[model samples]
Target: MQLIAHRGLVRSAPENTLAAFADALSCGFHGLETDVRLSADGEAVLFHDRTVATGVPVAAVTRAELSHLAGYIVPTLAEALDAFPEAFWNIEVKAPAAVAAVQTELKPRIERQRLLLTSLRHDIMLSMAEALEADTGFIVWHRPAALNSLLYAAMPHAHLRTLVWYYESIDLTLLQQANALGFRNYVFGAQTDHEHRLCEEFALHGLITDHPEFVGLTVTPPLQ
Candidate 1:
């Protein structure tokens, strides 16, 4: 199974910064997952939340403003990709608004086979799958039967083959149902060893974890 670093490591540096990501890579983690959002200027940047500490929406601020308020260098999606060219990335586009900017950035990099673009928005994931082909996309953070009826119907099951579910939302029955539909399962938000062990018990395909070096995990390189 693949053990991707969640927002890199958050050990020495703030989460999602280049410094934190570098720590994960230096520690032998080959898969890195981070959230992507569009700045006010339409620049694709790596950040986790919809809002900052002052509750200002990230989309309302330019990248420079965000960096200053955030108290850390907020790296662009391009900068992260360029700095870690060899690492496999799970770039979760956080909002529908980011899809266009992200698509533009990813189009030329498609041939690298090192990216898995995921989103909580069904339309966004489906759009990427349709545009970039199936394997490069994952519908994120939901149980299969719980997806929006209309939106799920619009999803091409044969094209998009994977789901990245929150750890709490998944169980064997849910996973079985998803597998019945030909979907591969990956669990996210697993921080403890027991939680990580639960993923192993379910025979999950992969998982995203804050601590990639946790015990009982094989921590293999990501699919390239």
Candidate 2:
């Protein structure tokens, strides 16, 4: 199973910053996951929320304005790709507007195998899957979507290449069912030691976590 650093080892550095992503790679994480949104300038920026702390919508501000405002350095998607050329990226398009910008930025720089594009919006994920050749995944955060995901997984032409669920929403049965259907299963928001152990016991494909070091250590036992 892959241990993906959520927001680039958020505990070590500011979430979604180049620094945070670099730190995760330096610590031997298998990959990094980040949220992407479009700035007012239509630039792909690394940010998690629809709005910043000031309650200003991210799309309403330019990249420079966002960089100066605060606690974290919001790196552009271009900057992140350049900074970490070899690391596998799980880029989440937080808004529909970001899909195009992200596609334009990533097209020539990396191959599809090195990236996984995901979104909570099924339509956006479908759009991205059509727009780019990258591996696409759907994030199921609610019960309705989870049920739908299962049904979708059973379909022969289901575009869902992967299915990620809220860690709390998944159970052994779901994991088995997804695996049986040849769907790669991943979980989000799995931060605790116990959760990491659960991921190992179930043999999940990967998990997103803020504390990669703690989870990695728990999942990687001594050779002896």
Candidate 3:
């Protein structure tokens, strides 16, 4: 199974920052995943949460302001992509507000590297699929919900080629269902040693993990 570092293996540095991304690369992970949201100033910044420690909405502040409150530099999507041209990217557009910004930011970069864009919002995935020929995935939890998205994609021929399931929701039946439809099955939130061990026996297309070392070393894909 392909192991993609979740939020660049966050430890010392906050996730979605250049520092965390660098740490992931240093650990020999070729694939890295992060979340994107738009700043008040219209910058497409790499951040996972909707609110900060002060409970202020991330969208309410400019990137600079957010950085100051966050106490660490928050890297923009372009900056992160530029810094890690060698690694495959799994970028999750975390909020609806980020959809437009992410599209604009990624338009020029998609063709430059191997990447997968995912979102829990079907509308965002549909929007992306319609806008670009790049691979888009529906992040889902329940089997019926995942099947619903698959059905829609099949009839309309969407760019959706992958299903990103929550780790707790994964089961043999679900994996079989995804494989039967010829869709890539990537599990998110599988970070602990127990979680990694549980996934070891399953044939997964990829895994979004915070602990890459425990997931066993899968062969890294060739970089674009």
Q: Provide the overall lDDT of each model, using Cα atoms, as 2-decimal numbers.
A: 0.78, 0.79, 0.82
Candidate 3 stretches with Cα past 4 Å from truth are 145-150, 217-224
Error of 2 at 190 (Å): 1.9
Of candidate 3, the 10-residue stretch with the lowest lDDT total is 215-224
Superposed on all Cα atoms, the candidates' RMSDs to the truth, in angstroms, are 4.8, 4.5, 4.6
> Which structure among the candidates has the greatest TM-score?
3
lDDT of 1 by residue, 35-134 (tens): 9999998899999999999999899999999998899889999999999988889889889899888888888887874888777776788778877743
Q: Give stretches of model 1 more than 4 Å off.
A: 134-158, 216-224
What TM-score does model 3 achieve against the real structure?
0.90
- For model 2, how does the per-residue alpha-carbon lDDT over 44-144 read when each residue is reduced to its tens digit? 99999888888998999999898777565689988888888888889898998888888898778655338888888878877666666667788877545
TM-scores, all models, native as reference: 0.86, 0.89, 0.90
How many Å off is the CA of 137 in candidate 2?
0.7
Which residue pairs in candidate 2 have backbone atoms (N, alpha carbon, C) closer than 3 angstroms, thus clashing? Answer: none
User: Which is superior by TM-score, 1 or 2?
Assistant: 2
Report how far off residue 117 is in candidate 3 (Å): 0.7
Per-residue alpha-carbon lDDT of candidate 3 for residues 84-131, written as tens digits (9 for 90 to 100) = 887899999988888888888778877787789998887788888888
